[model samples]
Target: MAANAPFTPPLALASLSGEADADWARAGAAYAGAAFLGGIALDADSRAAARELVARDRSEFLPDEPITFIDRELAALGDVPIQPAFNVRSATVEPVAEAARVCRDRDTLLEINAHCRQDELCAVGCGETLLRDRERLATYVERAAETGVTVGAKVRAEVPGVDLPVLARDLEAAGAAFVHVDAMDSEPVIADVADATDLFVIANNGVRDTETVREYVEYGADAVSVGRPSDNPTVLERVRAAVDREFGLEATR
Candidate 1:
């Protein structure tokens, strides 16, 4: 199945009037169209911290439900796709799993991010660094698989010789329902994606336009996640048009 197109309006619900938000999200999502919605995908490190704080505040322990934004977006769009994404890591798996459980209770899927390698993130042993910890990554998927709602592994196109394919295979072997590849690599080697066919393959990153979707298809992505274009309101409608143009999704206009 396809994910939501990117459509991050940069407007926090708490900071807006209900009327203003309804208007903005409607205009933005409608413009972003049928493409997948791009969102902040909670920061993995932030989730760990948020979980700890949430745990402390509760006299009786309850699972963390940091999916406030996802819920908000879904409510705004009604039937449009709004996928949950994040630079989640092995370290954050437990809290992430707990959050995913909460999402599953509501029929939402939790996307596990393994692509971000920001300086602050790498320093914390999250994101790409977790890639080096294969065992940890496997444990995460196998554990989440027990929840029966399916968890996604979002990995960047890296891993040297074998490239993203090997990573996707590793994730699939680990029980991940889908292995997500970030199309950030310009020199994408389509041959490297064959190993992913056994499992669901999703593409994202650097997909700022329609032509990029063609490239992602050429590279063998089963489905793709549109990020920047769908998320940025300035180009949300532009992206929706692009998805209709490129992927051939029916557009209302």
Candidate 2:
């Protein structure tokens, strides 16, 4: 939500929790220059709930320890503040509030994972399921905001029947600090979302280099994020240089 800063760094390292923990320490060091970094998305509820999600989708994985352990893993990133995204399967706001409190205590941001498409998560009315239930999602955001930590909602742009721009507006109205959109091949959606809300708009998906970074900026995104490509330092450097040259933005490193 630091959009007021002149020349905000256009590139950020997106969430890579499940697949990258083994290399997380090294990977975090490699992309330390990123303007923003997101920790792996985790289930913010009980282990039994996490296991149920995993059982439904073999690809879904959550840490075995308490959610606070995520704080320790993220601390390994050192100076690069991490916004830890969490997927909660609860019908109430207590879990969301607890996650937000953790982030607040850690002096970092908390992002609600409404962008994930895992089957098990969807079945439990979590993840993309929130997309269809905008009111409920807004309540969750509102609850998270009560913790006094910056709360962001991550959403996919391509979900059927859900208007991305309107959703962004609703989230902002609900006290969300920003809306992270997985633009997913549609740069204009970023434009629409940016136009609809005053909240910081973070563009995600298919970002590979400077051109893509500039493209999203031109489309009105406050910032752009890189996922898999951030695993390689050389690639991250190229994108960072591009952002600096194209937007006159300096890396915060």
Top candidate, metric TM-score: 2
Please state the error at residue 112 of candidate 2 in Å. Answer: 0.2
Q: List model 1 lDDT by residue over 1-253, tens digit each.
A: 2243222221111101112222344444445322222222245564453345345552111124435654554455555433333223335567556645654564544556555565444565666766676767777777776787566666665555435666666776766666666656642643366444466566666555567657666666555555534336655545445555655555434
- Among the numbered candidates, top lDDT falls to 2
Stretches of model 2 off by over 4 angstroms after superposition: 1-8, 20-26, 29-61, 78-92, 250-253
Report RMSD (Å) for each prediction in the order shown.
Answer: 7.9, 3.5
Tell me the deviation in Å of residue 172 in model 2. 0.6
Q: Give the lowest summed-lDDT range of ten residues in model 2.
A: 32-41
| lDDT, each prediction | 0.49, 0.66
Instruction: Write one digit per residue (lDDT tens) for candidate 2, span 60-148.
Output: 34555435655664466445433334333344567678767876776656778787676655776777889999999999899989889
